[model samples]
Target: MTSGSLHRLTAFTTTANGGNPAGVWIGETLPAPEIMQRIAAEVGFSETAFVAPAIGLERTVRYYSSEAEVSFCGHATIATGVVLGESVGDGLYRLTTTVGTVPVAVRKRDGNYEASLTSVEPKHTAAPEALVTEALTALGWRREELDGAIPPARAYAGAWHLVLAVAEAQRLANLNYDFEALKTLMLRDGLTTLQLVWRESATVFHSRNPFPVGGVVEDPATGAAAAALGGYLRAEKLITTPTTILIRQGEAMGRPSRINVDIPSSGGIVVTGQAVWI
Candidate 1:
């Protein structure tokens, strides 16, 4: 591996500096986990995806944040898929992540090689009242600011996330929170990020993710959370079955990302987006 050739890419958004940037290291062997975490910290992104070839086209991948290793990351996977598609060729690439084997399809569409990844099995559970209260306090938000339509829940696709729907768009726009308090709560509850969202319509939504535990204040685009959200909506019967939902994230952070989530009648949620090389 060349020291000057650490390849990196941004995923879930087509434009440069417009998505969640993830560092991608494609090597013959995996880097040491600690070293990976150090490099990820140096890169300063929410998560970095490392890929080591398992068998031919199949790859063994792992995600590392600045502080620790994550089970799965959507934006990183999408970025890795785009990198592979351009470096190798556009086709179906299998990434065996720590959570499970995830299949990502990459194709040259509209002159850009976009990638779509199907998440592992997703599930949701009711968030305990005390936990939600603590999170709200850490976020400096009142309980009345929450949307009554969608109750708080802890959702998991590959990683655990606390989903909270804000009542107004203004509440989502003004995002500032205590780092230490949130970090403690997230670590204690096994939360990767707080998926705060506002629904514009049945199929359109805007989201913000607070990821202090990952050593980032916020994540621009979160694919795992999107998948979990699809599962949650399906489980709660909030949206119609067999629906396509569009999620707009990272706008508040100035790195806008567009994610298309498809909820099927029965299986893992599918998240589609375009990634670009950095």
Candidate 2:
């Protein structure tokens, strides 16, 4: 963090302003937790990923919000990959996170660098009844407003998120909620974001993320959540295995982002998208 120089990148979009933006900080070693949080607050993105690669097999990578530390971040990982590709040359870069070692593959795609990360083994669990009730209460929605197609589940790829599927797209758009209440509940439950989604079809889905826990009201494009959704859908047999699905996000906020998810049999889900400088 010397010289106060911070590098920024827009992940999940080939062109600038098309995907969620993230700040990437590459330093000799990770800054103090408080210092990283301060830098992230100044960077003012949904999430900032800091990478401090260790020698040999592990690379320590940490994610931070404007207010605190996060388990993992998808866009920031992609952004960090691109930055690593540019500086270290394109190849596989291993990021040792608080959870595990995350491998990111960076390559030149159509003249612009693209980074795709393989998440730590994903895990999903049933959403708690009390948390669901509190979330529904905060969102001003009732039980009937939810979609039966995708039941409530707390899914995790590299992070934990509660998935709530609404039956209609409009429900996903009108996102006014009690920020403090949701944040309190999320903090208590160790939630990263609430994956609010609408299933348009078997292959196409639209989503919104309520991220009060991150000190942000909403997340425009959420790669980690998308990966979690892919795993949840496959685990529940909601979608067939070896399926490629499209997740359209950020449209409600006007920064439309598209994430291509590939669910393979017996492996971590692969989420691919392009990013540009913003």
Candidate 3:
């Protein structure tokens, strides 16, 4: 029989009602992949993190959505870090994900735990005109509505994401798209999520992510995408180096999540957020 203790927590929001919820399963040893998949489906959250060797500072972590296994999940990692901190005291925890090793620093702030996870080396590639057109068609977005300043690109921190920046906030608010069409396009393009965003200011942004591939309509908070955005901006020279950006997500969906991204001159991007018990 499978064995693990499951904890439910929401990431990027302090309140119990906000943020993206995830299931954290801690066990001395990981169960079979099939069993983990079943547990993820049963959890019914956007993602569930399976952490093995529950008693150590360094552990192996795997992420699974309701549909399939994901290479990496930012919010789930944040939740896992807090869970580990509560159980093993506050410190740095190392997680070995399928993509690479991620170091997460955990600390108690305002009587609640917060985690900062440094992603694997981030990179980006230009999105071809044809690919951008197809993605826009799937999302029912017109090419003119896009921000010409921020060209479409495939950005990756741990998982690949299509970073599309719209020119207006209203366009992002009315997010209506064909779920199946977007899912098919994402699968074909090998995208984990579409980072649909609107630049509110020089260092502030608002975003919405369509995650049909993960069997979810939309993600309230997407940390991996946030980190990818930071890397994309730095790599593409869209913003000044060694700056921090704040991403406000889930507001359109009523969850109101906040993700803080710290970008250095080089190396991995750091994604920081808070998680609360659900």
User: Which tens-of-lDDT digit does each residue in 1-278 have in candidate 3?
Assistant: 56789999999999988999999999989889999999999999999999999798899999999999999999999999999888898999999999999999999999988999999999999998888988899899999999999999999999999999999989999999989999998999899999999999999999999999999999999999999999999998999989999999999888999999999999999999999899
Predicted candidate 1 versus true structure: per-residue lDDT over 1-278, tens digit per residue: 22323567788888898989998877777878877888888987788888885235799999999889999999998888888888888889989998899999988899888888998999999999999999999999999999999999999989999999998999999999999999999999999999999999999999999999888899999999999999999999999989999999999889999999999987899999888877
On TM-score, the leading prediction is 3
Candidate 2 residue pairs in clash (backbone atoms < 3 Å): 13-274, 13-275, 59-96
| Candidate 3 worst ten-residue window by lDDT | 1-10
Candidate 3 RMSD computed on C-alpha atoms after optimal superposition onto the true structure: 0.7
Deviating ranges (above 4 Å) for candidate 2:
1-5, 54-58
Q: Tell me the spans in candidate 1 whose CA falls farther than 4 Å from its real position.
A: 1-5
Best-fitting candidate, scored by lDDT = 3
Query: Alpha carbon lDDT of residue 192, candidate 1?
Result: 92
Whole-model alpha-carbon lDDT for candidate 3: 0.94
Cα RMSD, each candidate: 1.7, 1.8, 0.7
| Superior candidate under lDDT, 2 versus 3 | 3
TM-score, model 2 to reference? 0.95
Candidate 2 on 1-278: residue-level lDDT in tens? 44333688888777676788999887667888888989899999989987774233246888999988999898888888887777776788888888887888889888888877888788899898999999999999888889998999999999999999999888887989999999999999999999999999989999999899888998888999999999999988999989899999988887888888889876788877777777
Q: Give the least accurate 10-residue stretch of model 1, judged by summed lDDT.
A: 1-10
- TM agreement with the true structure for every prediction: 0.96, 0.95, 0.99
